[model samples]
Target: MPAVKPDLETADAVAKPILIRAGVALIFGLTTVFVQEPSTLWMKVAFALYLVFSGSAMWEYLRREPVPVAMRSPLSMAAAAWMLGTIVLLFLSAPQAIGLTVAAALAVGGVAELVAWFGHRRAFLPARDQLITGLAGLGSGVALALGSHLNPHGQLGIVGGGAIIIGTLLAVSGVGMALDVRKARNLEADRAPGRVD
Candidate 1:
């Protein structure tokens, strides 16, 4: 019997929309700053919109998740919860609060990761990878958020929040983008010169 090849087609298709929305959301964020409609209420609305967008992006990722049926939902929910929880804390409190929130989130994520890691030992991504990524993103994002809210005034808060949001968005995107490019390179390396996916 022949081994079934993994469907790289589906993977690429899934990634496209996910990356597109994320990129668009970043641009929209920047646009909001330019429009000068970034009122405090408007900022909260932006945060809510971003949350919805993140949830959608996550749904796309989960479609390709290597976890089992029983585990996938829990992990997805956990990921969403942690992401939103971190964002909420950032908007509502100080950056230092992120430290405590991250500590708590990682603790919960650690347990779930440990369980999933043992259960899904065959996957390309170990559970701990997700755990670490979640924690690091939450921390940096909160720091950026806190930096934005400093002594709200005309020039400082305006530029500050803009820089912080854009900076964190780029930072978060960097890791995923690098991985995507690396994966494509590896694919190219494994195939003939004229071959492409």
Candidate 2:
């Protein structure tokens, strides 16, 4: 597969959505971290909101960006997972149900990201970032599923920890990608025809 050349528009398109996602994850992580013992209601509210916001961000990415064919399906499935999870969380107050819903969403989304990365590893720079996020998501999902018998607090901790890790990773990757694209554009312009030393 041919690599997509980085440029100003592409940089902005990718960076903006990624940074938005990072911000969302960080915000959710912080909220969960500060809460001493999150109640079932609190978990439902926070998880629902996070899923809605993050899923919308992913939808916006799909709508605005010219995503590669190999990635479009997986990304769509990930977004759908979030949406369905959001709906389930909104209705379910039991800890086990909530845990299971979250686990399914995270696992599905994580697998989607990994599949996208595997299929298009050579096509874009963000594929590396996707790998990290995928692993984090998958790990979090498995942890949550295993701890489904635990109380709300345990589930909150696992999900919150994962959010923070993924948030930091994406934030760093987005900033680095933007800078790299800018540098590439500058170098290309400098080496253009009729350029003077």
User: lDDT (CA) for every model shown?
Assistant: 0.46, 0.82
For this target, which candidate reaches the highest TM-score against the unseen true structure?
A: 2
Q: After TM-score superposition, what is the CA distance of residue 50 in candidate 1 from its true location, in Å?
A: 0.4
* Range of the 10 consecutive residues with the lowest summed lDDT in candidate 2: 1-10
Model 1 lowest lDDT segment of ten: 1-10
What's the C-alpha lDDT at position 170 in model 1?
39
Backbone clash pairs for candidate 1 read none
Count of steric clashes across candidates, in order: 0, 0
User: How does model 1 fare in lDDT?
Assistant: 0.46
Query: How displaced is residue 99 in candidate 2, in Å?
Result: 0.8
